[model samples]
Structure formats: C-alpha cells, structure tokens
Target: MKMKTAVLMAAVLAGGAACFAAGAAELAKVENWPRWRGPQDNGSTEAGRYPVKWSGTENVLWKAELPGKGCSTPIVWEQRIYVTAPVAGQDALLAFDWAGKALWQTTVGAEKPGKHRNGSGCNPSPTTDGVSLFATFKSGNLAAFDFTGKVLWRTNLVEKYGRDTLYWDYGISPVLTEKFVVVTMMHQGESWLAAWDKRTGALGWKVARNYKTPVENDHSYATPIVVRQAGAEVLLVWGAEHVTAHAAATGEVLWSVGDFNPGGQKNWVAVSSPVLAADVLVVPYGRGARLHGVKLGGSGDVTATHRLWKREDTGTFVPTPAAYKGKVYLVRDRGEVECLDPVSGKTEWTGQLPKSGANYYSSPAIADGKVYAAREDGVVFVARVEGKFEVLSENNMGERVIAAPVPVGNRLLLRGERTLFCIAAQ
Candidate 1:
C-alpha cells in the first residue's frame, strides 16, 4: 500500500503540480540573475568580477548556439540558464546547464514572427523564481514550466483577451512577486494590470489602468516593477503620460504622477523602462528628450508632491538606465553616457562611446565597478564608471545584439543573433 501511493505521487509530479502547489526548496541567492532586469530589476549586479576586456575568442568560456534569433536577455539561477526563443516554427523555452550544454527544450504555441528588423515572436525574457519558470510571447502564449521542463499550465492572452496593437513587438517581460506573477498591458485600448497564480496559472485579479495622452503615448512596452512602500508591495507601472502605482495583491490604484508632457508632444512613445535608485524612480520619456525623477511613496495624485526633478537636456530612448551604488547611469541611445545623482537628478559626470551609426538597443549593465554597453551594430564597449569615467575596451561580436549583457558570479552572458557567449577569466 505504501509503495503504490509513492508511485502515484511520482506519476502526478511528472505531469503537473496544480494540486500539490509545492515548489523547490532553494530560494534565489545574491548570485542569481532571476529576471531580465536582473535580480534587483535595475540592470546592474555587484556580485561578479566581470571581464572588462575580451574578444570573440579571448576569455570566451563557452558558447551555445541558439535555435533562432531572440532579442530577449537570458536569466540565470545558480548554474542553470533559461531563455525564450522560437524553435523551428514554434515558440519555445530552452534550458542550458553551466557548461553551455543544452538540457531540454519545450514548445508552447505557434510563433508569430515580429514586424521590426530586430523583433521576434519570443521577445519577452523568461522569468524564474528559483522554482518554476514563466514566459510570454507576441502570439499571446503564456505558459509555466517546472524545472524539469514539464508544462505546468498554458494560456493565450490574445485568444482570451485580445490581440496586442503595439507599433513594435511585445517587449515587456513578466515580473514576479512572492504570491503572484503579474503582467501589465498598456496598449491603446483597455489597458490593465493583471496577476495570475504562480502555480496554477489562474487569474487572480485585473485592474484597468487607462489614462489620456497624445497620439501613440497610450501604447507601452515597458515592464512593471515591484516595490516596497509602507511595509507593503506595490507595482510601479509607466505609460500614457503618467507613472502609477498599484497594490500588488489587489491591483488597486495607489497613486500616480503626471505632467510629463506639458507641451502635448506627439509620437513620444515609451520604449525604455524605469529604474529605481535608492528611493528615487528614474523615468526616461519623450523619445530621448526628457528624464524625470519621482519619489517612491504617495497616495492619489502625487504629480506635484512626489516629483524630485526633471531634465530635458539628456535621456535615453531605447536603452534603459542602470543604477549602481545609488547613482543612475544612462548609456544614451547614441552612445553618450551620463551618470546622474538620483536624489537631485543632476549629472555627476559624462562620457561617450565610439560614435556608431547604429543606436544602442541593448541596455547598459554594471558589475564590479565596470560598465558594459552594446550597440545594435554588434560592437560592445566596456568602461570604468566609478570615479573618473574611462573607456575600457571594445569588443566586436560580429552579429546583431539587442539583448542586454547579464553578469553573475564571475561570468558574463551576451545573447547575440547567432549564439549565447559566456565570458569568464578561464
């Protein structure tokens, strides 16, 4: 009788765990890059001694050839790496071990190829909580998988809700809290912030997040951020000419900050996501024309009260700013770099990379006092950004790269158009 019950449990675990709802015991550590924006959601990590000089062949620990091109950055936990890419003609999730060996591949739904030259069907990066992984695609496929590559649950948001009407590919990656995995949609019609059960894939709640703005300002490809305020978790979402906060559990609107476009600027769509530097949230808007700094806590409309400062002289359009050691760093779209004081929104120092005809699509990343910025044309520049800004070295990957550089535990992962290269001092 005991043996029969044990066998039944094993069979059920291999398929799905909705009834069990139990996950692995290991929690995410400081060395893990659990999500696309990195573990802290600011595109910087201090746990690794990253390489400042390396070529395609030098310091290349290992390279795993991906099945197809994906603009999403790879997330790492411990020795495992997870990435979302289209396999053959279907959207798929792939797993790889520490030694660049492919472990498994699981396909979820049909692929809807991207419209832009760098876009793809699997543009959103896969996120993990050190137990199960989650991914969303442009085709509206939302699926969860256990560590062993078993399909836990799957659904299509486009089929259930409606198709996305964004001008570019769907790029906002999913974010996770302790109890739920939340997704934000800020397109032209019926924008919302919805949460789903991390284990069962069930909808928990959805709250409307509509606002009035100029043309194309309603559409947002920026991911929502989880923050702590007054001993509770809040979601910081940016779109439609405002930055709003909502209760993570109930999806209730907490507060909002507006007046970003006083001139009613047209076609000033949001591309880069915001980053948190200590208590300040740095937002880049107006297609590289402006930057604003807002405080973290408030209720109702706090546009006038919570705003720290605003800058119109410099900002980024595609590359999100990276926060390191309480300072917000901007590797602007045209390779001009600026380090700002988050508290005052003042520029601390300024520098520039080698001027490139191609803009920067991959956001800058910092690890161990070094900065890594990649251009769309495949050249990556490393710089020392601590006291005096100094250019480190330039590396050419010889392929298009849109994914941000991920550094964790002495290894730097660069996802290019042809392969995923792991860099370390081996």
Candidate 2:
C-alpha cells in the first residue's frame, strides 16, 4: 500500500510538470505526425517535399520491433513515437526514439480479451499533447503517461461507467481539447460522451446517450474531432449507430443523426473517423456501406436540412475517407480507390490496386499531391491524384500493414506487423 501510494504521488508530480510545461501549439513540430491522421485529421501531409517514391530497401530510416498484436496507429511528438500493444496477458504501452530505439515500455493493465476478428486487438490509437501521451487499454483503462514511461494518472472507464458490452474491442482514441480531454464509452445501458479535466483527470461533464442500436456492437472505434465555428467549439462524435455533434465547452448534445446501418453479420461497419473541411462535415456513413456529406451549423435532425450530398458504392465503412480542397477520396476495404468531388459527391475516377486479394483497413494519407494507401498484404500504393489515376510508385514492405501510415513531413512513419519503419528519401 505504501509503495502504491508513493508511485501514485510520483506519477502525479510528473504529470503536473508535463502538463504545465507549455502548450503544444507553439512548440509542436509541424513535421511530426502527432495523431491518427495528423493535426487536422483530413489525412493531409502539408510538409514540403514529402516522399513520393520509397520502398523498404530505399530511404529507410529505422525499424523498431514490438511485442504483441495491436492495430493502434502510431503518434509522434518531438523525438519519440508512441504505440499501444496487447501482448501475452498484459497491455503494454511502448515509446520509441526517432532512430527506432526502444526508450520505455510500460505495461498498463492485465488484458481482458474480447471478441475481435481480423487480428485487431486493443485498437485504440494513442494521443499526445506533445508532452504526455494518453492511451486506452482493453481492460477499460484510460491512462496518461510521461515521456520516460512514468504513468501519470489512470481512469478505468469500465469501473466508472460500467463494463464494455460491445462485440469487438474498444477502439476510440481520446481527443484533447484546449481545456479538457474528451472520450467516448458507448455501452448498452450507460453509454455516454464525457470530458475530463486535462490537468487533474477530474470529470467535467458526461451526457447520457440517447442513441441506441439493435446490434450488440454498441462500441465506436472512431475518435472525437474538435471543430470551431462561429466562435464556438463543437466536438464531433460518431459512435455505434449515430453521429453526434456536442458542445465542447459543455457535454450538451447539439445535434445528432441516428438510424445508423452497421452492414450485417458478415458485413463491414463504419469504424472510420469523420473528416471536416471548409466548415462542412464529411462523414462516410451507412451500414449497407454508403457515404454521406452533411453541411454543419444546424439543430435537431439536420439530415434533411444540411446534407450536402449522398454518394454510394464508393464509400467505405472501415477506411476513413479523405477530403481535400474540393475533392474527397474513398478507399474501400477491398483495395479499391475512388476519388469524388466533395461538393457534388460525384465519382471522379475509380481504380483497383495492383496487389489483388489485399484488404485495406488503413486509411489513405494525402501528402503534397500523392496518395499513400497501405494494404493488408503489406503493399504501399503511391499514386498521383490530380484529375486521374496515375501510379507513381508501389512500395512493398512484405508484412501485414494494419495501422495507417502517419505522414511526418518527408518521412512516412509506418507500423507494420511486428516492426515500425520510417520511410524517408535522402
């Protein structure tokens, strides 16, 4: 008991120092990919002179080995990269250096294995505020840790809210706002969207969920996105069967669109996070697998009022679609790529990838003008997307690529089957 208390105190002090250090806005390296889809989550890599052509043999920076299986995306801050893994009977959180050296590995909690197909385990991606990293464990634990593997604080969402009653494992990554850290635990009876004090882990506001689906898959792997409009901030949440807009300052539900479709028994579901650009929320929804684009800034069932356009066939449930400029690109699970105009939802072009029989659960990354798509069979498709499909280069890593490749300037940080490789051209 004394040892636990001492460790807890040490963690608290370390957490305070990390939090009060400074805001990441001024010191955040624009070149490092900090989150799932970069800062804006539009899959945009704005760094000048990004890698256009590279393979496992060429322009290789380094590769670090991980212990277990996890589909969590890698996030970078400064000189470190963080990833979560579920190995043996423990869920481990690992930090690696820029040179692919192992820095620290902290095991968070005992694993509570659940039903998950397709080699996906503990799918929650890690999020960082440039100083401290926040991750979710399969045992229903949400923890924050410092750079040197010192745990700061942990909150078991299952103990607080209740156990996870979902079919697949939890996959929702925590999103950090200015004042709070927002998370979603969408269970059956006590489902809610809650925010905690970013500094102290105090519960801020938790709103009871009103939306429920008939399926036992009442779990959302989509992370929350923050959008500021009209001088007000709103957190966009897409869960099991509903997409909701909430007040960031409070836990009030501003608007929601329910009646979600999650495919079928042998069907795919919408696990991709939503994208926002030009004040318009581009969500690829529907269970039978259709995509919809809705304009924001409305109240109460805005589906009829703010829906810009609805596109079918080209949309995907797992791969989060990408929107840039006036166009949106959708990568289906079967390795098919389609580019559409976001304004009209019209398909610009569609093409099949070279690697046949490859499944694409990783989202496409758009850097400069090139699009990067990593397939499940370990092939990275590099193509030029301007008006038509032009394959630039196809890089094969020879391992299963499950997590999305994070674009950090000219370097692409890719986490493969058992190793994380940094691909950058000289």
Instruction: Pull out the clashing pairs in model 1.
Output: none
The window of 10 residues in a row where model 2 has the poorest summed lDDT is 6-15
- lDDT for residue 319 in candidate 1, whole number 0-100: 82
- Steric clashes per prediction: 0, 2
lDDT of each: 0.82, 0.68
Candidate 2 residue pairs that clash: 261-287, 263-287
What is the overall TM-score of model 1 with all chains considered together?
A: 0.92
Model 1, total clashes: 0
How close to the true structure is residue 8 of candidate 1, measured as C-alpha lDDT? 7
Top TM-score prediction, candidate number: 1
Each candidate's TM vs. the true structure?
0.92, 0.86
Tens-place lDDT digits, model 1, residues 1-426? 011010000000001101111124311332788888887888898775778777756887778888887788889876788998889989999998766778899999999987767677777888998889999888989899999889999989899889887777888888988778888888888988889999999999988888887888887877878988888899999888899998888999899999999999787777788999978999998878899999988789999999999999989877888999999999977789999999999999999998866877788899889899987778889999998899989999878788888988677888886588877765
Candidate 2 local lDDT, 172-277, one digit each (tens): 7778877777888765567788888776878889887755455543555567788886778888887656678888889787877654453443222346677776
**Once superposed on the true structure, which residue ranges of model 1 sit more than 4 Å away at CA?**
1-30
Global fold similarity of model 2 (TM-score): 0.86
